[model samples]
Target: MEIRTGELSNPHVIKLLQTHHNDMLKHSPVESVHALDVSKLTHPNITFYSLWIDNNLAGVGALKALNTTHGEIKSMRTSSNYLRQGIAAKLLTHIVEQATLRGYKKLSLETGTAEAFLPAQNLYTQFGFKECEPFGDYEPDPYSLFMSKML
Candidate 1:
């Protein structure tokens, strides 16, 4: 699959992001859901990407700058049909590479701690991310888990 920068105007990408956000809400309480919508993903500090295979969207992810030397992984979602195909891993690798090239010393993320979120938690762990305390504007919340990796 080829991964490339994306814009909010793409309807398919927009729908996938909506699905992602909705899924997060179902898996976590509203107060714990941190998934960004299309509009928020367009912020200047965020770089969004779509992974396409045979011109069909396979997954999506983004990197948001937390500060000059730190960044956050956001909106990482692989289409349901693409699950277990390593698409998320590939997309994550690309994001990590971009962060390293940008001179980010670390990358972090926040995700749900519910049973529905176990797969994502495993994926992040397999990718070398380790559990950590909340970062950014987030506060301590039992329903949320934070992870970070050195870039």
Candidate 2:
């Protein structure tokens, strides 16, 4: 698989993101769903990436710069067809590497607390992320789980 930057316009990438957003709503309340749409991912502070295998989009992820010393993981999703293929892990590893290279001292993320999110929680835990208080503009929410790692 090859990971490329800035493929938001690709139909496959857009579809994956839309699916991710929709799935988030199913797992969490609409008010608690923080998934960004294609336009929001295009913001200057966010760096989006798409992973492709044999020219088919396999997954997508993004890192959003929260401040000079911090970053947030966003929009991480693997195509349904690519589940269990390690696509999410690969994208996550790439995002963390990029954050470290950017001189970010910490990386944080917010994910759902629903059962559907267990795999994601496990993946972040494997990377040394531990549950933490909400950062940035987030407030305490029963449906949201916040995690962070000191890079």
Candidate 3:
């Protein structure tokens, strides 16, 4: 698979993001869905990437510079066709390596607390992320699960 920087103006990348948003809405409530939409993902602090396998979009993920020494994982989604193929794992590994290279001392993320998100939670756990209290603009919410890993 080829992972490359993505511009929000690209239609394929935009569509992948929209699909991810739709998937979140289907499996989580609006309030529990914290993923950045297309407009939000275009922010200067975020670097977006698209994973392509044989020219077909396979997945998408992003890293947001939360501060000088911290970063946040955002919008990790594997295409339905690519699910269970370790696509998410590869994307996550790429993001984490980039964060380390960028000098981030910590990497954090927020995901849904629902059972539908168990796979994601397990994936994060395998990468050494531990449950943590809310950070940044987030307040404690039962529907949200916050986690952080030291780089």
Candidate that would win on TM-score: 2
Q: What is the C-alpha lDDT of each candidate?
A: 0.93, 0.97, 0.91
lDDT of 2 by residue, 1-151 (tens): 8999999999999989999999998989899999999999999999999999999999999999999999999999999999999999999999999999999999999999999999999999999999999999999999999999999
TM-score result, candidate 2: 0.99
Identify the leading candidate in terms of lDDT.
Answer: 2
For 9-59, candidate 1 gives per-residue lDDT tens digits of 888899999999999888788988999999899999999999999988899
lDDT of 2 at 101: 100
The local lDDT score (0 to 100) that residue 69 gets in candidate 2 is: 99
Candidate 3 ranges with C-alpha deviation above 4 Å: none
**Model 2 clashing residue pairs (backbone):** none
